[model samples]
Target: MWRNTMNDITLPRASNHLKADALDIGLTEFIEEFGDQLLESLNRSNPPVYAGIDNPARQWVLEGLKRQPFPAQAQVVQAIAALLLDQNEQAGIINAEMGTGKTMMAIALAAVMHGAGYRRTMVIAPPHLVYKWRREILETIPDARVWVLNGPDTLVKLLKLRDQLGDTYDGRQEFFILGRVRMRMGFHWRLAFWQRRAGGGRSLAACPDCGRLLQDQEGNLITAEEFQREERRRRCDHCNAALWTLMRPGKSDGGSRRNTVLKSMCRIPTIGPVRAERLLSDFGEDFLASMLLDNVSEFINLMDAKGNFIFSDRQAKRMERAMANIEFGFGEGGYQPTEFIKRYLPDGCFDLLVVDEGHEYKNSGSAQGQAMGVLAAKARKTVLLTGTLMGGYADDLFYLLFRILTRRMIEDGYQPNARGSMAPAAISFMRDHGVLKDIYTERDGSSHKTAKGKKLSVRTVKAPGFGPKGIHRFVLPFTVFLKLKDIGGNVLPGGVH
Candidate 1:
């Protein structure tokens, strides 16, 4: 006989004298024993940390907690700090209610970590909260150097820090705050122009004196003019119509702005003034604009009027370098600003990652969510601050945990697939802790030819709370839960609710 304690069931071994009834019972018991275990183990894992308050790291956290003004805040900070300071723990969730000063607690934790020798930290927040996080960090840690990785000048700031990529920490504590949108963006070159193409293959230029078109002997438009006899203007040879002098945009006279911008582009080797002009004329403004935003590779091996390659290998390299020099802007590159920093910047650029409103990245398939996942993997440690860690289902936390606590996810045998979807694991998690409903149509007793067929079938799914196994795996060891109401009256001011 075999017994399964987990399911409280027993199964009889195969024997020649076994009765049919006994065999049937054994088969049913075996199915019942193994089925529940399979579902329960999907979202289950050993405690992330075996250490208690007696552990050295916990003691250090307790010591740091004494510095907090409120006892409730101190208690919450101690729990979070313990999880973060523990070597075995990679990530932790602070599910504190709104108005609980979660931001201040996070800052205090950063101070403790900084004092413990972790000098570098990165905070990824919503666009509106970028400055707020910076302010909080400065208010909490006076000596800390905080960098805002958002806004138009982000790329410029990153370029300045290129030399300091490998040296993220230089004794002084540093914090880099970035917005979530920019986390996955990149940089590329773009061109700014004002003239629109004229119709019928003609230039917009006209003779200033007679107000007539300037054409050569072949009837082709004469877009460029040569001055004669010390006079700065050229007269059309056909009708002696004085041609308008082309002046650079924002300038009084002489060169055209289009030509000037082209000239700057030609500084790239092998891309001379002639080829540069041809590029703008051939591709037109719309094509050039699109290429700048999405298809930069189109620049290499560009075709001419005869359909031949325009750029050489050496020239392409130079063009790429020149393109990299320019900063990316809105509608300029088909990537976010943060993506550029993540991809082009060196590895280990940040030592600590702080994600504010972290629950916003619950959808693993979204661009923002995927970007956050990449960023979380790049950092040495991560802290997720959110009011609603799990909206209503166990599946809600799966992707969040997968991104921030990748090692723990891997240890639990759940890995994201090529499409970045952990559907199998999510489904198993939903089955274990999520409420399920089954619905099907049932035939009415009377089969009526004229009456409406059958009643509509409706199924409702409700996931109320995490089961014991789920609480142990996702909540107890990795998360610090707190509510504003739990904080005693001593923490709130006299007028506060």
Candidate 2:
């Protein structure tokens, strides 16, 4: 009986003198009855168990809750942490409603994961929330060394990490907070010339020989260009000093994003030397630099150290418009500050990635979405936190799941093509799950019989929920969803509305 159970087959009731043929028939019937279950058990053993309330990592979640008391939130933190630690399950999602303390929960998970020997965790957030994530990590885990990889100073920060890649930090926990916009950017070197402008304050050009003012024939004030244009060994009319020689010398500064943004901000109305210096001092170089590319409205109501308004409303408006026009060109070795970390930072540098507001990456083809996908692929484990995981479409989850659970996607035969791209797989996924239909429209009211110039349009009218196969393949095994109502007032302070 034991042997039969081990082989997942049954033996018929024993007879005193059983025939060999009868015994063979009984074993065949038993094999047919249990073959599917045996195969299912074997397959289950291959994949790691999904993290649930009963997972061993639940202890870490309980400990974290003790420090920051959120019994209701602890349920989610434990489940996600378990999945992240599981060898087979490297990615999962925490789909909860808004105002449910997703940030706090993510911090708790980071704390637990750090305690469990994972030293590095990176949080990729919206540009506006980069600092907010850093602040939350610090507030939650006071000893955590938080790195903000979001601003003009990000390249410098990445260089520091690259320098220390070979060294060990004795198990010190490090957290890097990055914005989504910078994931695809890279850095390069270029030569930049700093030409001296002849305008504003320093309009007078000094003679090299005697330091006398050099003026043109008009006698108002000699421009630097006019002074340097003289073919002869020019001399000052007043002192006969070498005027042209002094005006032609050039200078340059390394073209860094920090310097470029500072110079650009200084050019805006009411943001002169004094205000620019104050702005840099108040917000730091990175915050000011990021404002040029994202969330410029953050500079609307500027104030001095003494709490006085620096720029009037009209001046602030002008500054906003000016900032919008400031372009960071790649040819000039200019880049968005976040690009340096995304491009040069080593792979697997972050053991865990927490994506806050994961739904924003639903547009799989967008730059930000692609960047998020790249970062997810680099990390060892990923936890996606989102209020709305799906946008009423099966295709919405396609790219997101492909990024988070990359190994699973590949195992399911959704791999990139021969050119090392996933475009074909993405298209196949859309065709399989998305509701696509064709629309025929006549050209300029032409009749149906006159279809020579008719256009056929392929439109995706309804992107409903995923089919059963998709759910079993992409969601059920890895995802853990919790609603506010499920926790109820027993866990929450007051029942969520």
Candidate 3:
């Protein structure tokens, strides 16, 4: 009986297998039974997590709706939060339609990262969006130390960062939000000219490279290893860079330090040279020091609501102009200058980037599109949020698609032509890349005809949004084309979600 049983038995399982798997086995079966459990166990723990606030789309939405309640839309916030945690990503574009709460979404995302202990978040927004960002941040994430980087003292703040040598809040993850205009051109001006005067009446060290502190420490600075290290390690009397150990000062003199007071005073509106001196003189040296230690809520209440200190119209107007100069092009009616801001933050700083309205960047040569590309270069993983993924033209997808998956887009062959941003060459490049999937052509020997059969070689077929010969195609893999009526079918009268 034993010999017979042995003959009927299958071979013993592999050494790696469990005793229960004596029957016939396959890879799929193995995975189903035990492999999945093993893998799940591996991911069950909260591995030292870092929540990167790249979900600007969600964050923006949250910011926009701060006065209102949180959107009941779970998918929107979830998609954005995931983007924030995804370090493999570069940039994100939240394409929710206007009034769908894009600003609030961005604020939510920023709050999440801040709650997760990530400080120093920089938001680059449109001019119209600046006050919105400030208010939303204040309203939603109350504890987040935020400062809209502005004013004549803005440059001084930048230089003072170097002096503090990382001892200051700005050195860490302080929420540093700027209007897009301020970011692009305003930033360049700030670095080029403003940085010199950033040190609260002091000057920052000249760039170790081209002497253009404006150039950013990209090409020339990267080559000099020691200087870069020292730059990071040493804090100067001005700027946000690190300073040399030799320069750190003792404590007693810290209170009277002109740079320290300047650092604290810059964030205060209307507190420039003259006003700053008066405040210091009247309140004594400990004026700002006392304010700094106050509770955030009280501190905010004291800023504008208190009648004694409102920013002067002159000061506010000057700041408005400066910020406008950055947002709009140099002239009056210019569009938001995104590219200029790219110089300040560059791409590498944020692990993921969220573009709020990705459709706005579908054009290959538009200043906004180019700016998005620059951001893409800096980010590791990118997610674009857009309801209108395609422009009426095929070329619109060229820039947007390239930014998402560069390897696949490049392998498929999409290269930009230099005639200008919206040129036919740009359209052609979209065709070369797999970005344009399908095409429908109308053939006409002598003339064209309709389905009436007068004579027709022309027809329409389902194809990709952008095709080789200036054709149209699908916007998304599975477009969730939404409308009010369709939504009303499932939603209650006051359904928040």
Candidate 4:
């Protein structure tokens, strides 16, 4: 039963291949032989404190958590911390099952690392789970500060954070949650250039720096609306300078404050369209905009003209919590968060990166995956949380490992080529750790002048199954597996999802 279940649950491995001296047993016969006691023992947690990490540090991790972890959960938390701190590993994986409290365990791991001097944690989560991540982070570490960077005002918020925040750690565990979709979403852009006259009163778009005539790659003169439909960054052939900047729609308020003010105000928690309109009418645009932009505290503590509190205490608290991590601006430009992180933020600005739904970033074609790679390089350490790591193909992990454990991958000679594409490297990784089938085909009765061998040809393709060496080298060193069964009867409902 155990052998068959392992084959069904995990990706195909070296053990799945035929072996000369392999012993096989059916599930019914094995169950009859082993009985219930052995199975029961397998479905429970083993209590052993992580080595080298003292009880005092463990207690500190536990003290900071709002909800006490079960023994099995605590074991995983400690193991992951030991991997990062003692083992000097760059990544840790949480392979917990669905509905088995994976989010709680990740939050606990963050808390443990927070005690170990990794104070700032960055989370890349699915779009739908951004608020859920914030909720869990606040629930687990009640004192921790969490920011959600998925809303429309993300660029403005990042701009403010860059200007106001200092390089010093503030002693509290801080979390910044960026939605994976928003991290790679396209931003509006336009070419920045000046007009230069080329005799006969004819003018053409010219480079802002070198005054060279701006043209497309084909050498045609550029028009003012050349980028109206699609905009991209291009460099001058001579000056080699960037010719594009983020599109700034509005520089200042244009007297139509009702729509913008009401829109931003309605984004706050518990503020409906009616209240948004009333607030705009009561306090005016500049006052409300300043409150939302500079001081959310004042808005939360706002009183009516009659000196009465506008909202109940509960509403005030909820708004304050939600508003603390968000920023609203009347005329902010759209900027991709990943681009902002790489270009504006300093390296290692975030201590740890906690990637939820980590397997989603494994796709070779996803822009989100490339953006994740950029962030992984920028962050000091990356911990990926995934229910599944591989999709039966070893190449699925090629780009993932190249992103997170880039040094190790480079040491193994899986680096990208000069063109910056890892497609060739991914093929190499697939051929190495995964199964590759060489298909040879020859025509049955085809006859040509030079076809005595029937035109024999071959093509190699990837097959399902990963090599044991790859798992031993890339997976086992960093991963911390936690099955729901391992979590045991005392921890959960004792049923599979």
Candidate 5:
């Protein structure tokens, strides 16, 4: 098994044939007949192509395309906006070569999302690019707000804000820039204090028997069912203390917290109450309100409020501890989009999920891939922008493809973690298929055979070549190969191809 795990299996290459004029005619006729369908699919699916345009800002951006010398950025912005506005099924992959202005395109798309009322936009990127992203936002979106969420110090500020404000009434519409690790870590919080403070938590009642924490129906200090069975409420047969103290909703109350406001203002780095107030004033009340909601929603809902649901405080605190466990500055094992999204974003929050360097997640076993999978599952729509999509193999597309079409993975017989490994079923399926190039194999007997004893040899197709004609063509079965060289480096001293 271990040998099978690491061996490189080579595959036989097949001979190929080509028919040039027929291919040309077929291509021409196909373009003439089904060109619109092809273009539509490209627009809807591929990068550097317009998907659709509906939002007004997107329209303006698209319209701006008509005026530019090249108009690539405007066109991409319009396409991304269109994809988001349409809430279409297909995600996007922008595979523009590096140094081709992907950053500008990403920023333009972000502006379009903001204009369309997207609440929170999490950008996962390398650490060096964090400042660059901020600069791009400032340059392209003059009226837009930005926040760089970096370092433990930043978390301290956010936690302080939560401790003071209780997840409400701070205006903040700022953009948050964080390292990819920080973005994955997201947020989680304990629900115990919330239960204690919120009136909806378990109620305090007297037990006629020996005192213990008991429910209203009064059985043992266990489940509500146990409480219903007992005639007299509360009191453990062993302990004699009052049965309950009325554990409120597992939520914290910053409203009653003295110095809550002071702590909120003081926690912000390099900004005391005076500076926090001044910054708040500069941005205005609405911005601060947006910020508080965005930064600290996990701290809000547990407050004993009207119609609050009880999901078990102990479980919630355990989850919070998990969320708070930071590894290498990223939220490794604790990535939870639902909780963070609920706290910070408005209902139906993100209009689009724009994934940059989408090819990075082509390996479903990767953390980036898993994290993107979560976001893709949550977002209303998703757009993956990457230039190097196929990467010389068909299975290279399978991982990212299945992630976007989440149901497709299941439909294609890809089991979920039945093997106790992160390798997605899609990857395994691709290996079963003929997409990935086989490099090695191992055998126990003298020959490789099926269970029925049928022999088998794995094979791969060799990359074809271009013929004398400018189009891609296959090598002839009978052909001669030759190369010309300056025998003494003097035949063509200043030559060029």
Candidate 6:
């Protein structure tokens, strides 16, 4: 036991030993003396060249913005604007550190782009910051119009937008603040089908009001999967009988229909079970359904039965401004906003799309990423706002870049697969400009007779950080990177830590 323990704890001799004579030499001197080619491989200094922001875009931002930006912040706005304006780039990134006033800078960017003929800007922000964006936009741009597309009335506003398209350019810049959650949110839906007697204790999914099998155009019977669609027509086609129901899913269908609705509607603000029952008794289910399913703007415009102008004034600026947290579940078929915009709104309806916390869209499987990508395609140009643009892995930025720089991505042979993400292209990118490791494991000195005795395996994994080629190709040309160090000394009382 002692011999075995000593053998186990023994140390092996070095294959090559360091010589005492070389101890006095510094690392650089030693490498130069023994391996001189290492000195030749060191890269030369490459500094970032700043773009001049003396153009009209800068003037527009300066003349219009209420709170003037610091010279460095102005530079960030100017640099990003140049990519969209002078260079005509479809997308640009502002990879600035936190506490850099990205909100104020973004408003200024909108002003600059508005001056350059990009009048409509859509900002996809976090839910908590939706109102913040609205407040900043309203305060910064003198006569600008801001819409918060993050509430329960989002669909109503979208419908209103659908109605107001193609109006003559009123020269007023409008900013639409869509919450990331709202952007990817899908509405509650069930395929409208009727119940018909099939005799042997079986009921097929048929039109609720009309007896028709839900089938595809090819005559194939529609599966339950077909009901899970992005955009749905809730009414029946044969007789226009309403096929779909409009209500949030309940815990269980355990009570009478009136009680179910009363219980559900009671959860919303401004109404309790008693008020809900009164509403049900007064308006009936069908009218309420129509209001809940569509025409939410009309509901908010409702007059008090005793004659008040909550009606004259859901348009009331005072009441409206005071109601910030008021939420409702009004929307059209609860379609995902991105899919709705893609199908209904015209291309280029929004002139610019500003993605806040842009790093959130880096995942290949992110629903918001796909939604943002769809919006990017719809908008004329895009500007991504992020603190950490690259999360070490090369593929992290693949889907994001594919969304923003689509034309260039396609030009470079990065196209989407059947599911619409450039996954294969991302793999190819990882191989080309990112690090990947192929690992092999084998059991050498063991002989086994069981079926589970297999011992060799190969696996591949991505390593951290993008390569130089990737930086030069995708990041260097498109990103406006600003650290706190750039503006900290001038803006903050203490220097950047």
Q: Which candidate is the best by TM-score?
A: 4
* Number of the top lDDT candidate: 4
Residue-by-residue lDDT tens digits, candidate 1, 137-182: 7766666788877644567666777767665456777888877766
For 1-497, candidate 6 gives per-residue lDDT tens digits of 12243213223334466433322334455565767554344322343344463666476656657877877788888888877877888899999998887888888988888877888899999765776788778778869988878755677788889999967778999999998887898867555555544556545456666677666668765544454462666665567787676656544355455555565456555556776777787777656655543334445455656765333442444333433333334333366778879999999999999999999998888899989999999999899999999888888888889889989878878887789656688888899889999999986645567544547889999999788888888898899978777885666666333
Per-candidate TM vs. native?
0.55, 0.60, 0.43, 0.70, 0.45, 0.68
Model 3 quality (TM-score): 0.43
The digit string of per-residue lDDT tens for model 3 on 184-278 reads 33221112122343444544444433344433346332223233334233332335443222222223234545555554555455557676676
Q: Candidate 1: list runs displaced more than 4 Å.
A: 1-69, 166-169, 184-335, 417-421, 442-465, 494-497
Off by over 4 Å in 3: 1-72, 83-89, 113-120, 150-173, 186-347, 380-389, 403-408, 416-425, 432-497
In model 6, which residue pairs have backbone atoms overlapping below 3 Å? Answer: 187-334, 192-243, 193-206, 193-207, 193-208, 194-206, 194-207, 194-208, 313-316, 392-465
Error at 426, model 6, angstroms: 2.1
Q: What C-alpha lDDT values do all the predictions have? A: 0.65, 0.68, 0.47, 0.77, 0.48, 0.74
Model 4 segments beyond 4 Å from truth?
1-56, 163-170, 191-231, 238-242, 245-332, 444-453, 490-497
Better structure of 1 and 2 per TM-score: 2
Please state the error at residue 260 of candidate 2 in Å.
6.7
List the candidates ranked by TM-score, beginning with the highest. 4, 6, 2, 1, 5, 3
lDDT of 4 by residue, 442-464 (tens): 87665668765456789998899
Residue pairs in clash, model 1 = 182-338, 183-338, 184-339, 185-336, 185-337, 185-339, 185-340, 186-340
RMSD of each: 20.9, 16.4, 19.9, 7.9, 17.8, 9.8
Candidate 6 overall lDDT versus native: 0.74
Ranking by lDDT: 4, 6, 2, 1, 5, 3
lDDT measured at residue 386 in model 3 versus the true structure, 0 to 100: 62
- lDDT score for candidate 3 against the true structure: 0.47
